[model samples]
Target: MILTDIVSRIYVLNLPERKDRKKEIEHALKQIGIHWQANQVICWPAIRPSSNNNFPSVGAYGCFLSHVAALQDACHAEHGWALILEDDAVFASDFNTQLPELAKVLSSEQADLIYLGHCHVASETAAPAGLNISTAAVIGAQGYLVRIAYLATLLPYLEACISRPAGHPLGGRLHYDGALSLFRQFNPSCRTWIAQPSWIEQRFSRSDIQAHWWYDRWPLLRQCAAWARKFKQARRHAATLN
Candidate 1:
């Protein structure tokens, strides 16, 4: 019901082989003084043959499963809400100060999905803490919140998506982030919201799933890429109202 309560049950989706990400996530949480559980990321090698061909690639399917794994656990947590984070997630400079108000927004609005961090589409306005409603298509899964009630429906939707391909009018593909947005689109009853100035952002990393070796590997390039990302986000944020 409060920020402390939300922080207590955070789940970080991470690949077992990526100890680098694991340690980095731990350090990030430490700075915010929060606790977390590392949910091991699912790998393509372990994927079922039938579902293997469903997604665009092995990495995409793996990412889908990792998020599903986290949702499965979070759906059954003692609390009615769950906060899910990817290992590469970077908190906003003011995340801690703003987080406490989230519980109130969650309670009053009864949002099915709350994007603590997101990308592609920026928040439309400088809405107050409890009022940043998502109006357009959004992407990124670096961090978000899930309501237990919605998770019950979400898990099943995801199960059905395994055989569906991305960009399907009928909710195809299991790429976690895209599917989530699709879920909202198809399920009109599901209410989704975003925390403006986003609570977290996915940092530059040679992703375990997506390709970008130059930016994810070299420190200078990574730093530059990070800057570029910031600039893009700022531009989107500014242009949202126009």
Candidate 2:
């Protein structure tokens, strides 16, 4: 199988209304020598929030469902791993060269989920020298790879959250990436990681979900908080393992 085929599947999430975004992503991928067929680039319709919806806005809900859709697809895929990307995600120039190395690391480590591109607000200290992967704290959903085995666990949990009554404790106050972080915290079996220097980065574009200025302005503070949370979670995970 070709190097691209090493990944069971690759998907780019696009909205029907964002045809321009789709074209832009296609162009970017072409520049990187990756060409995806129409079936591989899934166009998800944005979910409009209503009075009965759990999330704060239609955009938030749509974003959440789009990720769920990706996970659902991975659960049924014949391949062991899948790569999911948002339309605005851009590949690093070395991404093609690093793809095999990444796949080998994740497979050897048996990681459930790995962030390909995300904000660097998860840890205060750098990863051990030469280590490409470290535990993820607060990941952005722009680009990630998921193991099909882990999706088997994650998909059911997400479905449960979706079916819960409005106002339920686990209902919809959080974004999809946040929910995934919480899930990893609670479920030690679901290993997660981030690439030290991300292989992809999100291109600036009109965001579908609302933005928080506080997060943008105080990234160091956010990273500190994430580190604290991860520390507590590591302690708890250790207790369980013991």
What overall lDDT, based on C-alpha atoms, would model 1 receive against the true structure?
0.68
Per-residue lDDT of 119-179 in model 1, one digit per residue for the tens?
7664455567543666556788888878876777888988778766666677767567888
Q: How well does candidate 2 score on lDDT at residue 40?
A: 52
| Residue 210 accuracy (lDDT) in model 2 | 69
Deviation of model 2 at 154, angstroms:
0.7
- Candidates' TM-scores? 0.76, 0.76
**Which portions of model 1 show Cα errors greater than 4 Å?**
36-52, 122-131, 165-167, 212-242
Error of 1 at 15 (Å): 0.4
For model 1, the run of ten residues with the poorest summed lDDT: 40-49
What's the CA RMSD for each of the models?
5.6, 10.6
Candidate 2's TM-score reads 0.76
Give the lDDT of residue 101 in candidate 2: 68
Backbone clash pairs for candidate 1 read: 164-173, 165-173, 206-216
